[model samples]
Target: MKSILFSTTLIAFLALIPAGEAAAQLIPQPWVSVGSRNDETTFSIGARALNLGVEFGLGTEDSTGVDALAFVNLPLIDQVSPYVGLGLYSEDQGVAVSGGVQINPTDNLILGAGYHSIRGVNGQVGFRF
Candidate 1:
């Protein structure tokens, strides 16, 4: 009797959750960026959940050696929105500021070009879930 009751409760609880919400966890929303920082090549890879994003960056030889940015902007589906971020520049041992606008051409594709206080101009491509 206890086994049957437990099984029934588990089934009911699972059914109460939305399918889309559950499936979103299985889908990947990733982003990549490349550009110049301090006149050297920079690259970053990242992922997003809702409006929040976190990316790790390699700032090349001229700038800081490595950095990371954590930001919140309009969600990935939005056509255009300004993004403001705070980051760390490891070699300089200082805080980094990132700001730009991200452009979304489709539900799954994002394109961005912008300037930064330390990282300079960059173009980003991202995927939405």
Candidate 2:
């Protein structure tokens, strides 16, 4: 199941590079996106990776966590860009590094998959601007 998700994400990511490149030519700066962060079902406030950008969650939550991520945008096709990020998350369990890919299947939708340090796999979908 995890492999399937990762494979699908990779395919979608590659499919968008061409579109992204075309769009980049029209737009000077790269696109920016903001959305809710979640592990799977429960929504939480925190960052997944450092360079990926910042995310804040609304609600009551108490926990200290930090993650460092690096992302690169790839122009797959016109008006579409796919990006992949890698980073590490540290918490009570110590530290774990994770790698994931995000594909913008549409203008506002992002699909992604990541593996946590504790050997857990995560798949998520979020809206992006």
Candidate 3:
């Protein structure tokens, strides 16, 4: 069945992660974000492993969602760093295309604004190590 094939593929991919050349560059950090979408406020708590991050959201109207994002981190002349990402989302409201920009004013804090194709606009503030 398709499900079996998908599960097998996923397991194989996970098994190979530890052998990746960039494994040493993976930094895991706890992350939190608050945003607005579909005229409702949404909050997410998750972890970032290198350029990839996954989060679960608690939104208004009791809607909940999950997101998997991959981002590019760009460092500027000042201490600021900006990142852009594209990803997939699964939400109680509906599925969506998710992408966002996060800016780090300092090494620990982040200010972000973003959008989801189906969920609408978003903003966030979080701290990470």
Candidate 4:
């Protein structure tokens, strides 16, 4: 478990290096995301497809549960970008490391699915601009 977390963190850090540089040159945008992890409410805020972001859980079994996330987007087609992200979450079971992908259907709407160590499935919809 430690190794998995360490490796996931390492990969996320490595990916962020280029993302940070790219973000510096692009216009920053704000996005709001809401989802569920293990049937619990989840939320996130950040710029779409760039840099640092944060996510949190509401009504979570674990008190004060939260996750920090980093995202990078790749242009796939018009009005769509495929995104990859890493997340770390606090839970009653333990700290969790996770990664997932997001699909942007429109500039304002995003659909995502991912996995976490503590939570089995993650799904969310985000409004980005």
Candidate 5:
């Protein structure tokens, strides 16, 4: 059956990932952002592992939906970086694209501003805890 085949593929894919190595990434980056989606307010929480990040977004009550995003973080300089990503959203919002810059003035601090096709502009602050 189609479902069985998909399940097998999913399991196989997960099996190939180096779970232990990924969990052992040098820096544990946890961040949060507040933005807008189609003029409605949205908030997101995400984490970074080396050059990758994933975010989960929650929309306004009127909008009533969630978004999941995956990003590739590229370092541009010693204390700054730019990122690009794509994601899916609920409530028939469809796919969204995003790009942003992050500023790390100190090892324990992160500040960011970004634009999301579906989530609008957002500002973020993160730090080691």
Candidate 6:
């Protein structure tokens, strides 16, 4: 199941990229996202500097966690960029392996899905400035 989702995401990303162009910088922007994980609603606030970012999340479990992530973005024809990231979270959440992908349909809108080793899967939506 995970393989299928990964493969499909890869295919979609490849299909969107142009023949020749540099991948855009995806992590340097200040962004915020809201989503749900394992039936628990989550909210994240973060700022990305260069290829790395730091984020804080509030979960319905009544715990607040912090994560540091590294991102790689592939530009898929203009502003349609797809990015993948891996991160580590700390605090009451301890250390949970986390990773995700986000696709930018427009310059300001982002849609994504992610998985957390302890928190389960999530669906995300956000805006980038």
Ranking by lDDT: 5, 1, 3, 6, 4, 2
Model 3 regions lying over 4 Å from their true place: 1-25, 75-92
Give one digit per residue, the lDDT tens place, for model 4 in 21-101: 555425554454555566776554445434455555442465444566665555454343434344444445556566777
lDDT for model 1 comes to 0.66
Instruction: Score every model by TM-score.
Output: 0.64, 0.44, 0.60, 0.51, 0.67, 0.57
Note the Cα lDDT for every prediction shown: 0.66, 0.43, 0.63, 0.56, 0.72, 0.62
lDDT of 3 by residue, 67-117 (tens): 777766453443333444443444455664677677667767767777765
**lDDT per residue, candidate 6, 1-129, as tens digits?**
999999999778656655432144433556666666677777777666445667677654666676777767554444433344444444456565667776668777767677655445666666665
Predicted candidate 2 versus true structure: per-residue lDDT over 1-129, tens digit per residue:
999999999678657557754444333222222222344232222232212443222211222334445555543543332333333333444444545566667765656665444334555566543
Superior by lDDT: candidate 2 or candidate 3: 3
Highest lDDT against the true fold, candidate: 5
The residue pairs found clashing in candidate 5 are: 36-119
True lDDT of residue 44, candidate 4: 49
In the range 52-93, model 1's lDDT, one tens digit per residue, is 566677775544533333444344543776667777767664
Error of 6 at 67 (Å): 0.7
| Model 6 alpha-carbon drift over 4 Å, by segment | 1-28, 75-92
Q: Alpha carbon lDDT of residue 104, candidate 1?
A: 64
Relative to the unseen true structure, what is the C-alpha lDDT of residue 129 in candidate 1, on a scale of 0 to 100?
A: 64
lDDT of 1 at 33: 85
TM-score of 1: 0.64
Model 2: lDDT equals 0.43
